[model samples]
Structures are given as C-alpha cells and as structure tokens.
Target: MQITTNPEGRTILVGKAIFTPDEVNQGFEQVYKDNVSRVKIPGFRPGKAPFKIFASHVGIESMKEDFTEIAARQALKEMLSGKTIRVVGNPTFEVDSFDGPLNLTIKVSFIPDYELSDPSKITIAVPKFDVTDADLNKAIDNIRGRYASMAPVDRKAKKGDFVYFKWSVITDGRASDRKKEELVEIGMEDFVKDFDKNLVGVKSGDIKIVMAEISSGQEPVEIEINIGEIKERILPNLDDDFAKTLHVENVEALKDIVKNELLEQAKDAKEEYIESMIAKALLEKTNIELPENLIESSVDDEIEKLARDLSKKNITLEMYLEKRGINEEQLRAELTPKATNQAKLDVILDDYSKENSIEASEEEVDQEIEAISNAMKDARRPALNENDEQVRKNLARIIKRRKTVGYLMGKVQLTEK
Candidate 1:
C-alpha cells in the first residue's frame, strides 16, 4: 500500500491511496470471507462455494467496489495514524482506478494552520467609563427603588404608579376561568403592547379592557381588568435615616460607600472592555482560515442547540420558525456566520494553547466548581462534583480559554480611551 496527501487548501486535504496487486488480492479474499456466508451460491451451500465460482456468480469486476472501500479504510487508518491533524469527520472515498493499482482518493477537513501577526504590534482601543456624580446619583436612585414604599392613592393611576389588579380572559361576553392578581409597574409595558396605555388613566375600582401582547412573536390577547388598588411609590429621601436603614453611618458615609462601589464597577467594566477589544483584535489579526464542512458542522450543532433552548421554554424550533415567518434554511443562513466565526476562534485558541503549553490547573477547576456550587445553593440545584469527568472537562476548557485570553492580553497593546 502507498499513500500520498495533497492539500486542496490549508484545511481541506485530498489524498490518494494505492494498493498493490498483492494487497488488492488480499482485500478481495477478506471481502469474500466476510460476505460469502451471506449470499446464495447455486451449486453449493452458503459458505461452501469456491472463490472463483463466487466471483463469477457475483461478477468479479464489480467486487472492485467492495475492495476499494476496504482499501480506502486501511489507507485512511495508515495515512492518519500518529498524525496530529484534527479531522472534522470521516474522509470520503472516491475510486480512482479499479483495474490499475486499486487506487482511491480521500478527502477530509483539518482545522487550518495559521500564523498570528505580532500581538505587540497590534493596537486595540478599549473604551473606558468614568464614574461621575450623575452615575452615583443613578446608583442611589436604584437603591431607593429597593426600599420604596407603595401606598394606595385616591387619584387616577398615572405613569410610575403600581397597578394592583385582577385580570381574566373575557370569553364571549363574560369572564372565563380564574382571575389572578397582577402587579404591573405602569409606563413600562412596552413589552406588553398597549397594556399601560389602557391603564394609565384608570382609578382604583375602575374596570378597563386591555389587549396585551405578553410575549413577543405572539398575537395579542384581550383580557378584562378588574381594577383593585392603585398606588404610588414613595422613595425615601436621601438622609441619615435612609443610611441607618441600610446599616451605614450617615448620608455622607452612604454617598461615599455608593460612590466607591460605582467606581469599582467602572473599573471592572473598563477591564472587561479591554479584554473584549483584545479578543476582537486577536481574531482579526489572526484571520484564521475556516473549513466549509467545519462551518457546516458547527451550524448544525447550533441548530440542535437552538432546538434545545426552545424546548426549555416549552416551545419547539418548528413553532419558533412558524411564528417568525421563516424556514430552516433561512435560520441556518442566519446562524452560519456566527457559527463559522466561533469555530474558527476555537481552532485558533486550541492551536495557541497547544503551542504555548497553556492549561488549566486543578486548583482553577476546583475554584470554579466551588463558585458554581455557591451560586446555585439558593436554587437548591444538584451539587457539582469537581472530580466528575465531564464537569472537569468543561470547566477546564473555559478556564484555559480565559487564561489564554489573559495571555494574549499581555501580548497585545491596549490603548484606553
């Protein structure tokens, strides 16, 4: 057997496998042995037929196709053995010649080999945010919303008012089924179509009809609103009393604390922005070559993920597409570019990790798992065991990627603006 590889592109490989006459003869014998018992030979029982008779009965020339497959498999095994190429899928085989040397051509996808331009030479601009007094004020305002008091008001409900009411689907001319109390923050129903518009002028004990579109991609539903209580939110004045309630010294001390928090958030946001810009720059700088079948396979995985995500919401991909007025082809077209880019990035990061000998330590995995367990303690979710194979693998992948990103951050030139 002889093998020769020719790259059609950086990633797509076209190779040829040629079996010698002796090897071809051996392949025929193997095929005959494997299939002889499965076929009906006229003069003898299933496995009792001689090779020449079996070949004559089955058309000896046609057996070349079966032999080609056997040769192709052996060729691929020998050709790819000990090679570090990340094959995307099984190589496809094409018979080159059945009569001479039993030749075959094989094709497979490998993640592209790429070179990165000097990271130090690449300039990336990262946006920086300065925490101002206005930002502090906004932060304080958000904190105020937490301690806000809602008191029933006699006037007509207005914007920013809380409308505590019961609503039911009006079937025919009467209310149908049960009514549930809904506390809606008026003036924020843009997500619910015209819900707030219909309730803004209503007073306590005043009934109204609202057509609400609760979820996007769905038609509006008509419901009869039974107004119960209309209340206005009262935010406590920023004073020593408010500070004491929050376990702080005084208003000045509270302002200092909140201002410091805003500053820290701004700093964190700046770091995040820098990291994101660095990643974008790295991808653009490297501009890795992506294989078509790799892109296609990635898109397929994305589609499967889309289906799973929809299933979690009690919806199906078919339903989502129908509601969106699109087909699977159109959805695939939309997802193709994103999937392609992600696959390319994964390839580059994997290659970079290998070249740099970068890896995630067991300590990092343990810490990540501990953080996950702590985060989910409130939900009472199943505990994650760090020693679990899949858990460790997934966490290690994420951690190594972050570490790789950090390494690239050190390699690049970041300008904050």
Candidate 2:
C-alpha cells in the first residue's frame, strides 16, 4: 500500500491510498469465500457450489466493487491512525480505479489551526450578593402556594387566578379547527399566546376575544375565549404545623432550609450566566475558519434527527416536505445556520478542553455508568450491557466533555440573580 497526502486547502486533508493488484485480488477472494455459504445458484445447493461457478454467477465486476469498498475503508482507517485530527465531518471517498491497482482518495475536514493562551490568566470579576430575609419569606410563600387548593369563585377572573375556557383560533378569518378541547393554563406561557394579558380581567360568563400572531412576519389571528368558570387559589396558613408537614421541626427550621436552598440556586444561576458570557467572549475573540464539509455533515445529522422525531408521529420526510411546501434544497439552506453554530461550538469546546487539561478519570466514568444502570433497574428495565470497547470509550468521551463544561463554569465569575 502506498499513501500520499494531498493538501486540498489549509483545513482539508486528502489522502490517496494505492493498493497493488495482489492485495485487491486477496480481498476479493476473502469476500467471495465469506459469501459462499450464503450465496445460492440454480443448479447447486447453498454451500455446495463451485467457486468458479459462483464467481461467474455473481459477476467479477460486482465482486470487485464490493472488495474495493471494504479495502478503501480499511486503507482510510490505517491512514488516519495515531493522528490528532479534529475530524469535523464524515470522510468523502472516491475510487480512481478498481482493477490492476486500486487507487482511492479520502477527504477529512477539521477546524483551522489555532492556539489558546493561559486560561488561568483570564481573570473574570463575578458579582456577589447575599440572600435576604425577604427572599426567604417569599420562598416560604411559594412553598405554601404549591400546597394551595382551589375553590370556584362566584366573581370575575383576575390575574393569579385559574379560568376554564373553550377557545378557538382563526387565521385570516378562517376558523382553525385543529382541536376542540385544548386546555389552557391561564398563567402558563405554554398556554395561549399572551394568555395572562387576555385573561386578567375576564369574568365568569364573559367572552374575551383577542388577536395574536404565531410566527414573526405572520399576520395576526383572532381567537375567541369563552370562560366557563373562575377559581381562586386558597393557601394554608403558615404555622408550625405547616412546617412539620414539610418534615421540618418548626417554622425557623423551614426558613433556614429555604434560605440555604435559595442561596445554592442563586449561585448555580450565577455560574450559568457567567459561562454564557465566557462562551460569547471566547467566540468573539477566536477567528477560526470552519470547513464547508463539516457544516454539511452537521446539517445531514440534524435532518436525520428531525426525520426520526417525525417518524414517531407517523410522519415521513416526504410528508413533512409536502406539508411545508418545501424542497430538500430549501430545507438544507434553512438548517445550515443552526448546524454551523453547533459545529462552531463543538470546535470551541474541544479547544477549550485541551487547553484546560480537563479529563474524566476511570472511576468517574464507572460511577456514571453504574448510576445509569441503577436508575434503569429501579425503573424495572435493563441497561445496555454491550461489551464493545468502542461503546465504553464513546461514553467516557461524553462524560469528559460534560465535566469540561463544568470545569469552565468554575473558572468564571458568577452574579446572583
């Protein structure tokens, strides 16, 4: 085997592997022998056919094609061994010849060459804040609200109250009969669009009409909401017994727990905000060139995921395209930006991990796997117990990436919310 590297561009590496005729013939023979037990002919039993007859029946050209594909994969794997190539996309291959001397080319893409300076020197000032007594009181109030009960009120529906209504949406004066009994939780954002604003002053037996736009650039659509009943939330009195119900000895103990919980949550939120700030700062400072092949591969993966999700709902890719009135090219173009952003993030995180020397220990990995297996068992299920070394390595890599993100969070400044 002869290997030569061709520099297509700065970020793309193309490898040309040339295999001798003897090597190609050997591969073909191996494939033929493996398939002999499965291949059937008209005049002979399954595994009793002569080699020459079977080869003639299957056709030498087809055999050569199969042999070349397998050999090319092996050659590319050999060429990529022991290299720290940040491969961002699937390899592209081309066969220059299938006979005499098999010549195959493989293209791999990676992020452009870059370096990171000392991350420890990157000082960040995190804003600090203290949890107040008022915050604790508010948290206690929220906890009481969770155990609150609702009773039908013989009055108007106000903000912070529950309203049951039958609603219908119309687009351009045409009624959309999608579903009849879709329930709307008044204050929840997942309900009707800006439902709080629409339901604030609504009274029982009152019909409130509102107009809302679905997507940006789309025209406003009218919705009719007919309230059936109104309910007011009634909370239990905050006392020592209320605290005991929460497994706390007294009101003071409950307040202390709430205060600690709030402080921890505030710290976590601050850390998250700082991590976002750092990512944006790093992305702006970095000038990395992304290969087109990487973007394309990412888009392909995204589309495949979308297809799988739709399949769960009995929808096919062609059905989605027809419903949306879009061609494959248009869909690809629309998804490119999202895919590019994901690829950029992957490159950035990988570089950051290497610079910070972030790694997951074997013990940490084993703990994670054990935790997953235990969770599965508790759910009365079985875990994926594959003995494949590659599967274990991949899981370890995922855990390490997660840990790397956590490590970066520790290095930045956090401001309490």
* CA lDDT of each prediction against the hidden true structure: 0.84, 0.78
Candidate 2, which segments miss by more than 4 Å at Cα?
1-5, 15-60, 63-90, 96-106, 121-130, 152-156, 166-186, 212-228, 300-335, 351-358, 370-395, 406-417
lDDT of 1 at 104: 87
| Per-model root-mean-square deviation over C-alphas | 5.9, 5.8
Q: Pick the candidate with the highest TM-score.
A: 1
Candidate 2 lDDT: 0.78
Candidate 1 colliding pairs: none
Tens digits of lDDT, candidate 1, 1-417 = 889888896888887888888888888899889889988988799899999988888887768878887788888888788788778866798987877578888898877656866767878777758887889898998899899998989998889998888988877878767998888889887436667888888888888777777567677878888888888999989999989999999989999999988888888887787777765776788867777888898999999999999999999999999989999999999999889877877777777788789999999999999999988887898779877999999999999998887787788787776
State candidate 2's TM-score.
0.69
**Candidate 2 lDDT, tens digit per residue, 153-232?**
88766766887777678667755666244434467755645647777777788866688664444567787777777888
Per-candidate TM-scores read: 0.72, 0.69
